[model samples]
Target: MPRFAANLSMMFTEVPFMERFAAAAQAGFQAVEFLFPYDYPPATIREQLDKYGLTLALFNTSPGEVNAGEWGRSVLPGREQEAREDIDLALEYALALGCEQVHVMAGVVPQDADPEACRATFISNLRYAAERFAPHGKRVLVEALSPGVKPGYLFASQYQALAIVDEVDRANVFLQLDTFHAQKVDGNLSHLIREYAGRYVHVQVASLPDRNEPDDGEINYPWLFQLFDAVGYRGWIGCEYHPRTTTAAGLGWLAAWR
Candidate 1:
């Protein structure tokens, strides 16, 4: 079976951090990930990870404003200093907790931004991150946001993501595939996986249309997981979804996955 990690940051938004980790553990998850662990000290995070015996699969950099509702900004142009600080903070946390992947947050693109300039800036930043994290045995995972979310997202389609990966041109900078955004932007999953197998390093899923568990929406996760198996792709598959109700109530897909 592929390793499953709970996306504690998004999936369990209602619960406290430590309690969320405990809940994922009680539900039989051996690992969990969250975004922006900047507030919690690295020592405390290590203690929690040890207490739950949970491997840390992924985490993202600071979005500058956690409460105003920003996910991250690594790809935003003219924000190199901010991105570097965020990366360093994340590195500190990852080292303390043994995190395997740090999703290099491509921040939202500014309106009327020069496409060529933006891509160049982002790629350069990615190389900086990849080089820094490679020596530490962690990867800098780049995720493509659906264009619907932000204009000039830099990498919306699998091909676009691959282009960035190829340009970043580092073994340690890989793709982060989330089913929700992938379906929204690429509209094809299996074929994309086959075409870009080597570039992929992490996978996440939420039901189509609703962004809930697999059972709550249109996509067939059995088919999805089957495709993953067929392609011989193996890594930490995360449950990065939002709940229509409570977090626990949204997990109806667990018993349904074979």
Candidate 2:
């Protein structure tokens, strides 16, 4: 089985954010990831990681005005400066916390906005980020979220994300393959992995139809893990699902994996 990383933003919510690191470590997770880390100081987060002997696997750029429904601002037409600032901020935290990868959030677009403009902005922003992160030996990642879950998300399919990856033209840029989104929008997971095996730098997991634990979902995770092994995917698998019960009680699936 592949190594698993717990998503503190989605899992282990039964405890405080600082407490989640210990919770995940105790539960046998070797690493942890989350959506955003801006709320806490980097040094504090580092202390927890060191204390628990846990690796900081991944985290995202700031989600602009999350309460207002802005998932990310990288693709927004006029927020170029703000987007770059977010990228810089993420890098600082990553450098301090020893994180190797950062996810760039492409915010929702208005229905009337020009698609070409959005694509151009996204490409430009990605190129800028890739250059900035390259010197630090860090990588940037983008994901194709399912429209059913996050409407107006820039890329909703592997093809769209891959196209952007090409446009960015940076070797350090790669796709973040989320199994839940793939099942929702693009169902052929095996073919996707075979076609784009080396393109994905990070992988996230959740159940289809509902973003819940993989154990109770219809997804054949065992087969998927086997497929990943066959494809030579040696990256960390992030558990980005919501627990049906208390986070501890809902970890039966992980117990066996550990």
Candidate 3:
């Protein structure tokens, strides 16, 4: 079966962080992932995962206001040191929670940042993360942010992911293609799936325009699920969408999704 995870970052906002972990477990998701577990303690997160028996699929390194100020601006060339240091902090959490991937957010391009240099920094930072986490059996997957998520984000296309993947060229390094983002930036979701399936380390979904449940989207998720089946993408599909209703009310999706 294709596993599922609740992206606690977007799905359980009304609950406390620890309660969100509990909620996801109660909802029957075997794993969970989130962005920036900065507001929570590592030991607490570790204990919650254990108590709930949920795997930590992914979590991000510290992001300095990328949601406001350059969201994820960590991969600029000059920011390599910062990126490494941030990942080091994340390492403690990753180890504690048994996290599998970290989103090395390549923030919006700096005014004077050379594109190549920024991309190089992104690759270097990924290499550092891969090396840092390999011994712990963890891999750092790069989540390419859509322009909507970060207006001037570095990677907005699978093509860009390919370019970076080619440059980085490491077994542990891979790409994450979110359906909403892909639909926003690239029209051919099925094509991207067929073409870059090998590059995909993770997958997420949401309705277009509204970023709601998959059932609310115009993207033909039934066919979308078929596409995943065709591609043999036997992996956990992360529910990383913003809820259209109260988080608990959004539980209606469970019946449909199940």
Top-scoring candidate (lDDT)? 2
Off by over 4 Å in 1: 66-71, 256-258
Writing each residue's lDDT as its tens digit, candidate 2 over 187-210 gives 899898889999998999988767
TM-score of 3: 0.93
**TM-scores of all candidate predictions against the true structure:** 0.92, 0.97, 0.93
Top candidate on TM-score is 2
- Cα RMSDs of all predictions? 2.1, 1.1, 1.8
Residue by residue across 1-258, what tens digits does model 3's lDDT show?
A: 456789988998888777998899887788898888888788888888899899988877787665456566466777677778888888888887777777677777777768777777778887888788878877777766677677767788877877787777777777887888888887888899898887887888888889887777579876788788788897678888888877667767566545
Error of 3 at 98 (Å): 1.0
Pairs of residues clashing in candidate 3: 66-71, 72-107, 73-107
| lDDT for each candidate structure | 0.79, 0.91, 0.79
Q: Give the per-residue lDDT of model 1 (tens digit) for 1-258.
A: 556789888777787877787788877788887766877888888888889888888888787654644456666678788888888888878888888789887765566677777778778888888888989988998888886665555677766877888888898989898888888887778778788786888999888887777665677778878788788888878888777778877666675442
Candidate 3 segments exceeding 4 Å error: 65-68
